[model samples]
Target: MSERANAMRASILRSHGGPEVLRLSELPAPVPTSGETLIRVGAAGVEPGLDVRTRLNGAGWQLRFPHVLGASMAGTVISSPDAAAPDPGTRVAVAPNISCGECAYCRSGRDNSCAQREFLGIHHAGGYAEFCSVPTRNLIPIADSTSFAVAASTAVSFGTAWHLLVTRARVSPADVVFVVGAAGSVGTAAAQIAALFGARVVLGSRTPQNLRELSDEVRALGVVDTTTDFAPQLESIAPGGVDVVVETVGSDTWAGSVDSLAPEGRLVCCGGASGGEVGLTLRDLYRRNLSLLFSTSSTFEDLRLVLRLVDEGRLRPRVDKVFDLADAAAAHAAVEAGGLQGKVVIVPESAA
Candidate 1:
């Protein structure tokens, strides 16, 4: 497809700790095998959870990198042999989950629940470089209406939100949804998705910038606010406690997320950014019919369904910053600061 393949680029890994570990290094370009497709990645996601996992010594994630960082990407299919399933030159979104496909869950369309599942950036080489490879089956064709950057940013974040809201939470019109960390990519998607289902959307974050940066589409859904106190503030707004909470802040907001839940409200958790331990009251747990659901990457089917909404203008992704794939160190520093209102992206070998 390309005149040539395999070029060097920057990648990161902290020496001791912090964002500095992310250093760009020269590495070989990626090549796709027979059943695989070679994607000349145009955009790669730099998510907070990705940074945390990378910093935590791999944290049991399926994708790996002492060299690359980025679990998700969007790019054009540069090369795919006729034997490939997705076809060549298709603009596509890279699904994060990597599986055997013959697993029970995979056969049942529950690949996210596959016991042997491995995510892209977490388990294998991810999109932080100029090119990445995947089985043709993992890509869903992107319409002319969507851009490569848009396809790249949606995979893990939006797909996960769809599974939590539509599949597990079963959000309804009567529900009052409290989305913690409301400005982050996934948090923002969760809020928007729930609102689309007719649920009342309520947002909370630590900064006014979050309230300001994520304000546009969130305003279209419902009320947006910055609150430091979770219980009182949520109660003042929702009154009877929230019916659902999409929490990724972890221990920092755990009590607050739980406190704000109504009797039968459920909390769907996918990350733990603020640390993991929390103080809880057993009486509250037993008396309230609160449910806690945990999930990982989404299936291609969920990605395809969600992307249809994006193509139709019902869902729009937020991108805060862009960096060359080699400048992942800068992206990590920005992420660690905790102020970005949207997902950061890395472009490989295309710019300074």
Candidate 2:
């Protein structure tokens, strides 16, 4: 209906390989279908697993080439065909996971496990552009006190972290929670949520600076410690081992996470941003009485709670840096570089 509504600038991935595959181009703006809404994207987080995993190796999802790649996005709703949806101009955080509402899992409050679930960036077009369309059910309202970048940073990191520690593992005050990749966004969020529930947190990261910074932040919130040397340091500090371990580095930390857990401990894993495959033994698992759980992406209710915590000033997701939408290649390069203590956000040039 408006000039900006006609066409938009977007980072298009014509073919998947590396950051070099991302190209800045003009594309037709997406129009909202009957139950969908068109958002003018303000900021989107460049997540490695969503972008790289899906882009490089397809990440178990069937592909459509020339796709836009971004999962964590926040923006203003410019058009909503659904009369009962939030009014146009409402600032909202995008919930990028779609699930079949009629599924048994969906009706049972386990939408994350809905058999017919699809991720936004992976299954369809997502927020690496100026304007994008999504189902109205995916929008999470944001407060004026929240910045678009901050809101965009939370849904993925905090939602997954909250679900893993709070819902899956059921971390408690007496539990000692160990978070791998503590400098990364998900790791940091996991540590924070664990601390919020009164758990003793042990943060592990290879980067000295990331460990230092995250350790400081967690210590400020509750009892916590950081380690650059994961297994050895964990053994020395927590001699008896921890009750819960949150691992995202996958193959890199899999063995160590198993070794660091206490008897009957719970180990929750969401992603393997580092490497996927890892060796495991059935005898070791049964003997140790350890429970290994895999957490998929979080639910809408999880996203809502994360937003509420952020809005209330209890949880904070790191925004390491921001890149203009046109500079998506550089953003991907930074993500690939690793050792970052926060999320790398891409702001639409129109918004920037």
Candidate 3:
């Protein structure tokens, strides 16, 4: 807690061409600058995207490296020096995108869709450290009832869900929401968040196991009706079609996700795990009046709502597994493996 107390932490890069390049080493720790807070990172998520980019030159999918390997983090605020430190011992989940808030997209309240958005763990230094600085605006206060790990899992994973489903998709009571790739982190978050908004959640994935995991989480969250097939299942449930399609499971299921929508049904997209190219016929879109609503991250306002929901105990995050900072590579491997029941996190405090 001293100003001159130099900090040592880890910074990683995998040669940008293969997983063998994922390397970690100690470096001077970060300090919070203006409008930022120095969070003593408890855990950082080693997501599936991190593994793909590490192993396959992730830039192919728009992933950039030479940065810390995690995008989501949960921890207590340790310092804000000039500004007020977030209450000591308060577990805070941080949303990582740092956009130039003065830009056109930002002023229009669409920061998540900003063209020049600087992503943490992508364009900037991120959460895989003893202490990483983040904008005060990016922190979401987790209730005492929530764990640091759960809160951290929400920052990006849940925040993205909130933005896509609540903000853009705007699921209403009784809306039939079909979430594709229904078991990934975002998929799981979307299903729970959608159901909390009163949507009847339907989950579709490649395997019954994946669908089963999501069904379990959904039911625990009060959502039922998870399915592995889209065509017959959609016809069975909505008949007319699903009211909202949360399309995070790219390439592999986009066509199906899109096909399951109703006349006015909206599609809120986030990630593209399977592949990016989704080929569909114009006949389906033009005839149905289907809307594609793409979004990401909870706004400052959206974050507040999500936090309130957490406080109300209406939403809970599921953890797949946790790894220490040194085992970051393994964590990424787990995410890419994908049959996970929930999110994978990296504990910086994890013993090497």
TM-score of each: 0.90, 0.95, 0.87
Which candidate, 1 or 3, has the higher TM-score?
1
- For residue 251, what is the lDDT in candidate 1? 86
After superposition, candidate 1 runs with Cα above 4 Å error: 6-16, 60-66, 213-216, 219-227
Better of 1 and 2 by TM-score: 2
Residue 232 in model 2: shift from native, Å? 3.1
Residue-level error in angstroms, candidate 3, position 114: 3.0
Say which candidate scores most in lDDT: 2
lDDT of 3 by residue, 1-352 (tens): 4342585556477456544456668767786788888777777776565334634565544544456656777778777854555765567877777777888878987777677776677666777776777887778777778776777677677778888888888789868888776667787888889877777887766654556655765653222233444577568656878888888778767777787788888988876766777787878888888888877565666766776777787877788798777767677777666668777877875312
Report lDDT per candidate.
0.76, 0.85, 0.71
Top-down TM-score ranking: 2, 1, 3
The lDDT, on a scale of 0 to 1, for candidate 1 is: 0.76
**CA lDDT, candidate 1, residue 47:** 67
At residue 71, what lDDT does model 3 achieve? 70
Clashes of each: 15, 0, 4
User: Which of candidates 1 and 3 is the stronger one according to lDDT?
Assistant: 1
